[model samples]
Target chain A: MNILAYIIQKEFIQIIRNKAILPMMTVLPIVQLIVLSNAASNEVKNVNVVVVDMDQSESSRTLNHKIIANDRITLVATSFNTNEAHFYLQENTSDIVIEIPPDFENDYINGKQPKIQLLVNATNGQQAIVGSGYLKAIVASFNAKLIQKVIPDISISKQSNTTISSRYWYNPELKYTHFMAPGILAQLTALLTIILSAMNVVREREVGTIEQINVTPLKKWQFILGKLIPFLCIGLVLFTVGIIASKLIFSIPILGNLPLLFGYTTLNIIAVLGLGLLISNFADTQQQAIFVAFFFIIIFVLMSGLFTPIDSMPKWAQQLTVGNPLAHFISVSRKVLMKGSGFWNIRFEFLYTFILAFIFNGLAVWSYKKQV
Target chain B: MNTPIAIELDKLTKRFGDFIAVDAITFKVKKGEIFGFLGANGAGKTTAIKMLIGLSKPTEGMGKVAGFNVDTEPEKIKKNIGYMSQKFSLYDDLTVVENIQFYGGIYGLSREKIKEKTTEILEELELTEVSKSLVISLPLGWKQRLAFAISMVHDPEIVFLDEPTGGVDPRVRRQFWETIYQVAEKGRTVFVTTHYMDEAEYCDRVSIMVAGKIEALDTPHNLKQQFEATSMDEVFLKLAR
Candidate 1:
């Protein structure tokens, strides 16, 4: 125990003595939080739209005017030519082209469903999909407006049978940043801690310091613990910094127990640190450590449900999330912070992350060699 | 000094899959003696030293370092020995005093003992004036001397040096060897490995390895006479060839 304390003291001294560590720990998270939280939003606004009104009917012209006036749509060019609209899409100047077929008013006045053509650029899938959805909402509202002028025989009360109302739970405003900020914070915390610890043991090896430290009477578990305790504390402090950033910058509500978030983050950082140290054990250099850690981190982030919804993923990919600690962490971060969930509500996520922490740290300790 | 066998081995070996890194060999080192481990590159000198210093497991046979089993009690052996690797292993970013203190502290020394020993080492190296300077700021020779001193922080029964004077000039090497002599005069066994056969003459006894086997073991003067050679280097050439 005395030896462990001394080793810990020695590690802290080395860490503090390193001039770059302080700035990296404090500055990196802030930059990442500011950039990533804003950039990773699921909301795609300002989609460039090309309008082609062929029928020149009241409804078609009105649709053109609606598309032009909508805040989310950029009316780059509106023309009577269908080919000209296609040209805007080809030039990459427009994300969507709305083509109204001729005789559209005749069908709409008779209460017949009119077919409106939508030419969407599939290159940027998110913008294409969301932009098209917005255009449909506009068309639906216009159809409802046209329903008011529906042949005098059809009564208003009979025509409007169903009107849907939505109340978004957890995030009433449905602010995309509120939903995404916690996930991004989770990602940044994992990324920074992984990169920081991945270089530690390998740096000792690269600089030839491991050769000295290994010969000491330090047990493998003791040495690994010495390494882990400092990094765990560092990970907590770094995560605390990120949590503050999320609140201050994105206004992600701390609705649930704050200590629960921290406790989970502690478990999450341990899993990541264990993974990083495991990489360091096999990697011969700091460069190798970072690269290998980077490869795994990319896998972790992409499959973690951080940027994309796991429910939408293929079944195989969804199953793989079982092994990914970050996925569970992001889930708990969102649940605890956004939904005001207690430990019981997020028990499964908490349990999985805890299990993953043990597996990873167990592997790290098992792989570490005191003698070979 | 009373416990005469500092190191003893019989057919201790290490194999890397298909290739044998250190084949079965045998030797004993006396307490308080400076034993020079001489070899050409890839002659398994490092593999052998690794076994003695408890960094590697011996594949076959048995050995004891400071009366502890190499195979089973490497942890016990670690407590009784000090090691200096081929590369400079002290933290370059740490001050001379801090490095010494850390090494002593890891060996389970108390704060006061570490502080006392730190001062003693700094003064003995005549580095008290620059004790606060980062080790990186020191000359390579001073860094090496400091590394050697740091290895001795535990005041162990035997010190294993894996090519400690690797890349220095002859003058620096001689100065470092003089420090080794002073340490051995205190009746501590010194086991040092080097490719520099020229330094072999300074040892009380020497062993030359080639291709995973010890080719010769004797005092430098006796080995020279036995090989009809003028110097240890000439004797090394004959044996390695």
Candidate 2:
């Protein structure tokens, strides 16, 4: 019976009745979550390597065999010609060419530093970086084996050899979907909120209903909340659907508290809705609102660390991520869902996000002028 | 017994930078009277109505609508008046009854009151059979009529109609004026702006605006008599030229 209730009811009726928007809100997020989660992974697998074993020794043979032992690294060909291996790289038949020099075994046996050259095609940056890393680890393990072969009863100084037994904590197998699903959920919710909130009032303005509504006794907050509440509810529903899918479909771990994640998610939705409201204020029509939302969504999604890690970004870009709401949501989602992060661990992200929400909603509400 | 003034404007002006959109316009309309605002394109008709309807602030003037100050008491004024624009502003996706309910509920009407009003308006408009249909499916003339009825859903003391009958056939336009007449007969002031000259003759009083000022204000008969014109269209043409 409240005025705000009427406005919100009207918005729901319209949203339900809209053919374009209904599918976009319901079917689109489901498909985006499923497709983008699978498609936007960063894991590089099955890098084909050409072993140019010029040494023709046991050490070279052992190293080449060990490298191709895993499913992640496959041996395409073994050749004595370096030029032929280089040709494989150029022709795109191989991603990495591991060349073993003639004295590779003897040099290691004579207490000399031995080197093996790796010609890696860096066209696909992630594959090159990760694939080359796997190759180096294999070669290093071979050097450790050669050191332990009891050469002339020499007691080697063990102080120089510090093997790092690294253990991945959250995702032990480094499952890409587990890492990506929560971030994708955050991205989709933020995106939906931004789009719906941005367009609601703008749609009214385009249809000229805003002119009629503006002349009414409808409070400014009522008009704004009327637009916001519906989108906020939709954002939450979208987030919930994503959460369920991430759990049931992807089997992504729910390490942190559900109530806490839901709380943070609600706050994040409000923050994004605030941003959308700000956009609606500046845009005179629905098309303008969508274009403006698109511009921000692209920047926000890219900077959100959804597809890429924030730590890998340049210093200034990392600093810019501090203001991005999507970035904060993705970080919080991953931490809570993957790392079992408690409130104390994510307190900074929550605080910064709250500040963003405050500023955005405050400015948006302030900029709205019913009289003008 | 005399009717009270529904809207009063003294030196109501609106300017944008160096340009005067509505220049020192002054007028008053009694309650329950039909007032037509006649103007050429860009003749400051919309600007003046905006100020009276509390959508705009007067650059330098005093205005009172429904016994509330335009500038200072805008919130109170807003509650006291209704507005229907030339766009026939209704949600096309919403059914006719739903639209009525939305407007009524927004005006703080109870659910029962909204239902009662919905039934009354639909019956009066002879749209009871199609009340559950989407407004977009309705004919243009019917949409305009529904828009007028919805604008009065709150039972406001005054309803501002901004070209409420534009683009409709003459018969539909005449029918639209009959609804306007019915509202005025129920003692609600109707302030309307229109491009149509014959529509001016239906108003109890019409004000002709030229450039940024009201050049003439009177009954259409007196305007015809003064200008030696046979019809309201000839009188408007003479003043416009």
**Candidate with maximal DockQ:** 1
Ten consecutive residues with minimal summed lDDT in candidate 2 chain B? Answer: B1-10
TM-score of each: 0.95, 0.93
Error of 1 at B191 (Å): 0.9
Tens-place lDDT per residue, model 2, B1-241, is 3769999889988999999999988989999999999999999988888888888988898989999999888889888898998998998999999999998988889888998999999999999999899999999999999999999898999999998888889999989888898899999999999998888888999999999999999999999999999998998899998
Cα lDDT, model 2, residue A95? 98
Per-model C-alpha lDDT, please? 0.88, 0.89
Among all windows of 10 consecutive residues in model 2 chain A, the one with the lowest summed lDDT is A148-157
Minimum summed lDDT over a 10-residue window in model 1 chain A is located at A151-160
lDDT string for model 1 (A155-257, tens) is: 6685558878899999999888788878877887888788878899998889988888889987778878888889888878878887887788888888999
Best by TM-score: 1
In candidate 2, residue B214 scores what lDDT? 93
Give interface RMSD, every candidate, in order.
Answer: 1.1, 0.9
Q: Per-residue lDDT tens digits of candidate 1, residues B34-126?
A: 999988899999889999988999999999999999999998998899898878698888888888877897889988889888888888999
Error of 2 at B138 (Å): 1.1
